[model samples]
Target chain A: MAQSNFDRRRINGPEESFQPTFEDDDDRETRWKPGNPRIGRGARDIRPIFLTAGLINQANGSAYIETEKTKIACAVYGPRQSKSTTYNEKGRLNVEVKFSPFSCTRRRVPIRDAEDRSVAVQIQQALVPAVRLELLPKSTIDIFITIIENDGIEGCIAAGSVAASAALADAGIEMLGLVASCSAAVVGKEIWLDPTEEEGKASSGTLILAGMPALGTITSVWQSGSMTPADGIKCMEACQERYTDIHAVIAQSLLDNAQNNT
Target chain B: MAAVLLSKSERAYIQSSLKATPPLRADGRGLLDFRTVLLETGVAPLANGSARLNIGKMAREGGGGTEIVAAAKLEVEDVESGDGVDGGRVACSVTCSPAAYPHLSSNALDELQHDLSVILQQTIGHPSLHPRNLTIIPRKKSWLLNLDAVVLADAGNVVDALFMAARAALWDAKVPRTRAVQYRAPEALKSAKNDVPGAMDVDEGTSGFDTRDMARTAADFELPDYWDEGETLDGREKWPVCVTLNLLTPRHFLDATPAEEASVPQRLHLMFSFVPSAPPTLQAMRLLGPEELDLKDLKESIAFGEQYAKELFTALETKLREEDNRRNIKARDRFALMR
Candidate 1:
């Protein structure tokens, strides 16, 4: 079946959409042969990030983060009474990631698509280890992320984990440490950290890693594509190196918000 | 996959027993051992290739073993319209039989299906897959292989069974050979048409080919009537298979039962290509559970997963070959009887 499930609640876009074709298509294929510098930046550099917490008025806690062209807003709903009829010992953590219809090159449907659900699962796994669900038994913490703009799938997921974790901290939930995530595209022999959609198109492999920088523990690892063991380790290590920086951004913003409240 | 439930006493017994060196699994298998798997290919007659696998049960009529049926189907379409950004692609979906898993909520079942399908889809996107071989016409037409699986039963480590069945199905899958390909309109490649076993069915002059603009061309291809003469998917043997390692702290084991899974604090699922090398290509890896994995365990799990994947691939290869031989013998016997 070709997309049998559509969101009847909202007016849908066309069933098919195509990426715009360019004039210089023939020569473009040979443009990215290894060892050449990326179009605008060094391979090791990531887009400058802007992050903050506690923005939403109705939600328990909220955070918004922007990285170049990508924008993500996250909100944490509750650790209050769960709606489940059955009894649960350890609290439940639910993560939902949604991309706006116009967020990516192709128009996403109003309903949750596979890309959004996959990212949501990754974010939940990344933050589960850090969230002390047992302390809030019989309750559930729901995390929702809205992507206004998506630069790359891997980048969006890594950023979503960071934003979700920061929002959880802002909600005053007890936790081990913040989960900082980063991703990179393995293009040729080089590793481009926090690759954008354009850079990601030519890469052979992609890796997104989430870790607790303070606790020095890995919370989640989602990697795909083809790569040697050495390259996989290299990509993982590259991601680990940047977590402290990303964590610092989240931690500093949280500190700034706390001081302003006082 | 909803979490299996166990009593505190059972959990404690399993945890304490498994934490020791040379950990004793509930099934009495060694650390690097796999549960017995019984698989039969060509189980689905209409599909290109299919396999039904039963793990944790030796008797065919047994009731408790985890069972799964996997099928790989192929369809040809224009490359630009295909969902794949690079080349031909594999689309995977899984559904858990409610008869087997009555306890799982609808939401849990949806989530489980998505996760299982993602692992299969991403693993097949490995560079070694060589999807370009699916090209019927360069940059124009390619094959899209749709892989679907049904989890009939989940004994314990059902994901392993699912992965094995999928790999075997693709292993036995065949691609229809394009005897002749006519790229756009009236200019049918006359030279390539005479060698085919079937009469050519070409759509005449729907559009004409312009040598100056070959990029926007459409292709018409015909498959031979004899399906057995078809070719296998390119680089089928090098495709990766998943090996899930359950960590009970201090020691890890190959396949964990439902009771054993409930006691385990963490699991590491690694997908490795069955290439014969010191370190096989790591197609994909994911960590599941509530605790952080130690570096030692992560490293050990990779090496362990690689070794295990190779062995498992070997076992599957032999099984497929044996099944082929059996089919050939039966076909020959029928031919002699008819003659």
Candidate 2:
């Protein structure tokens, strides 16, 4: 069989393999799906919650999280002044996503290019609604997310948003409540939670939502691909369920961090 | 954030601080002390391989603030002729993203990037073996290796931080394989026939020599006759480390932090390559300042840089060899499983 574009890109020697392009369907789907079955879970029960507090020494508060396959490091920089004058009504949040040159399966070219900007916008849109921007007018909290490793897109965006929130809280950013995000995808009539990159690409639809479960308000809702209204609702329900679990983890992480610092 | 201009008093105070101890600082470290240097390789999961280095005050931070992360990504492409005369060439590029230091301007970052790239090429690029030697496979197809360095936090001493990061990156780099076929030109074959007057008479008795025979002969003429299949071509590049010396007062420091660098009147950066059992080669050196350094200071800095380079090269080689051994063991286990 002819090699799939994803396989071809993945096996193109070690260097190029680091920056594998997500343009191909296979690459997109596989990378977006949950853990690979080949790895057989790897004693998940013995694994840590993949959470630790106070990782970013420079930031006010920071955290490092690694799920079975996904790894994310988030640093929260400040409640400092907003750089621009237009966004003065409320505190502004700037989100930046940087994939290290070797982050993917191909050698990623490090440039301030368009891709970085788009991802920044995606993250910003997902986060601004969740943050209590009006609380600290004229100030800004910068969330820097470095995706050390990505297993799938399903829960990643949500996980990353939650991680950002934890870092923000660690930084002492006041907010209405902790915002946790999670994703669910409809794969061949099955609702898979945190689908891997591969399963996500093959799924009929994906829904990513970030909210403060305690407040019962959805801050961000992003849906892609095709899905019936019922499917969307079901995915949203799945996301909410996942969010509750993730939110508890975030709360615990913040408490643990506070205790450690003391 | 708006820039904070250093007042004259601040600058003078820093200068005085350097001269107060006559080369020894309040930290109990000598003027030239590099602090404790620690390097960890293959830490970043997303990267092919990455390294983190902490030096000077940063090392004191205990892997916290002021750390540098350098990653190497290998790429293969049709070797272009301008890449040089060599068959296969490896090129490295280093960029420092001081996102943590938003006060740093783009222009300043660009200058540092250029400086780092030049240092890497001088230290690692081989005019004889790299691109030049790879050229034998034709420029149409070749592999290029790129190394990127990112500064996660900047407490100070970027040069030492960058150098250590780059060293770990180079040690972690793995180049892909390339196979080459050699054959004699038709004109050369015709010339060989003309040179041998009795060649036609013995043509029937002796086997005809085609391009493959010429290639075989050329291969045999070289040092080793049998090609070592399954042998890794990794880790062949020469190791070179760049040393940056800050000229402060009448004294010279091996590495200086951002604050120390700002206070200095002049700085000298030297790139040197040290191959084992051979004399060290000065790959490139540049002196920077508004005023030229006196001959005495220049000599002192050169001597310091050379000595530092020797120690650095030896330490790095030992580390690389150990890592290589671990990798070989891993490969052997995987191979055994396949059987």
Candidate 3:
């Protein structure tokens, strides 16, 4: 019989269709081992990274960075007049971070979810210290980062920090030093450096650190899950070491860009 | 719409310049010349279509350069049965960053959002421009187009950048293909279902429309496999692009910066969409400020707007073509490397 088209659920399907099942079903005890070749190398090795600056022509300064699994692009516009009337002597840095609806493994709603907003605020705090905002008064610099694809939340933030810093540098904004970041995932006794989506999901804890290696100042540190104080310190040290590597990559990228431009 | 407070002397300078035979703007551009535009599409990889446009380059010394980013995503969903329901829906939203205008009041922001939404809808949402066949399955399903725009920087002439970026994004958008199934009842039973006492008593007069057709055919409808191809919107060229002019009594300027906009007392927004075999037609026009111009001035502004719109359209087409070519080359190179 022909049915009326009135007030029908758009697509007829279960509210939650497919259940998530982990591909690695190895015994939990054997999942991560201190000396196992794969587990040991996985905890210390980072995916190859790519970084570029001045890619977004519209933005005063722009940078694009990508790892094997994570991709982020950032644009910096301003040092222009600020919209607020508060008489702040220092320049204001406004940071906004967004994940595209299709950026995650599962499609997300386009709206800025709580998680996105929180990350944005965290990023803003991490970046503020590195920028020499007192150089420009009554102006605000806007930094926007879009996570095109996210392999791990920690990795995304770290990459976004570096990219935003590069964009700031590209925009010719004064800064004390470039901020570089890295994340490590802790599973049992093993701390995996630059965890991919799979490793992040299986890990018990994550440690993310942002710092200006040259200035020896840690700009921001973020942690999720639980770990002993000893384990946390070790993870942080590993992240600091990784930051040096990232800083070199960024320095080289900016130098190459300058050479190409000239 | 002076975004910033202008002092008396600066205001006087602009007024005197406008009163001249040919208006000489502070930046010294001709009255009809638009700000230099730099637009790039496909900037946001995860979006179906995306574009970033800068109305003016960031000035090295002074305040200038309004930047906008726009993204368009299309989703297939059930639409109510109606005359134009098959043509699909377009929802456009504009959000300004607090950095755009430091002291922008919430009331002003809300008003700007409303005006932009209304103008964009009127410009891009023509039934003929978005055909039913492009995204419709009668009463079963249709496409809902969500067009979101964010103002990255507000140096001035935000409407122009927003509209241009929106048009570029839409031009780059693609709609996925879908297959629909129809369920037909047996002849004898069909008449009974249609003639049932309460069946005919449905809301309004639309009794024959099957709202549950999709639900009933849910099991039978063969959805597209992963390998199936998607479709781009038809009649995309008919989608309108906007051109806003700041009319300060006797003087009219195209693409006014915030400083210039503040000096003006009147502003007019015009949208034009090209016809297949005819000249571009005015799709919509609105006066933003309280002061209105005389009929003669209005006529002259329309003519200028139309001419400038054609130039912008040609420039956009060329840019899109160049972008497509570059994208194709990149893909080809990657494919070659893999092989």
Kept native contacts, fraction for each prediction: 0.77, 0.00, 0.00
Give the range where candidate 3 chain B is weakest over 10 consecutive residues by summed lDDT: B287-296
Tens digits of per-residue lDDT for model 3 on A1-262?
1133222544433434333555767677657444554453566778888999998999999999999778999999999999999776778888888898679866555554545655675577567777887788999999999999998787888889989998899989888889888888777578888887767766656667777888765666555444443455577788888888899999999998999999
Decide which is better by lDDT, 2 or 3: 3
Which candidate number would show the highest TM-score if scored against the true structure?
Answer: 1
Tens-digit lDDT track for model 2 on B207-252? 7653444454322111234332222234343445667777775777
What's the chain B TM-score of candidate 3? 0.80
lDDT tens digits, residue span B160-212, model 3: 77778988888877666666666664579656767777664556335478554
- In candidate 2, what are the lDDT values of residues A1-262, reduced to their tens digit? 1123334334344432222345655545434334433122321111134777689798877878887767888898888987776646667788887766565554445544334444455456555655677788889888888878776654566667777878877887777778777777666666766666755666656666666777775655555544544455566677777677878888887888788778
Q: Give the alpha carbon lDDT tens digit for every residue of B93-164 in model 1.
A: 888887767888788888788888887777774554655567776666777788899998888888788888
The interface RMSD value for candidate 1 stands at 1.9
- Residue B3 in model 1: shift from native, Å? 1.9
Scored against the true structure, residue B45 in model 3 reaches a CA lDDT of: 77
Runs of candidate 2 exceeding 4 Å displacement? A1-262, B1-5, B44-50, B56-66, B80-86, B126-136, B178-237, B325-339
lDDT of candidate 1 over A152-260, digit per residue (tens): 9888999999899899999999999999999988898899999998788788778888989897778888878877777877887888888889999999999998898
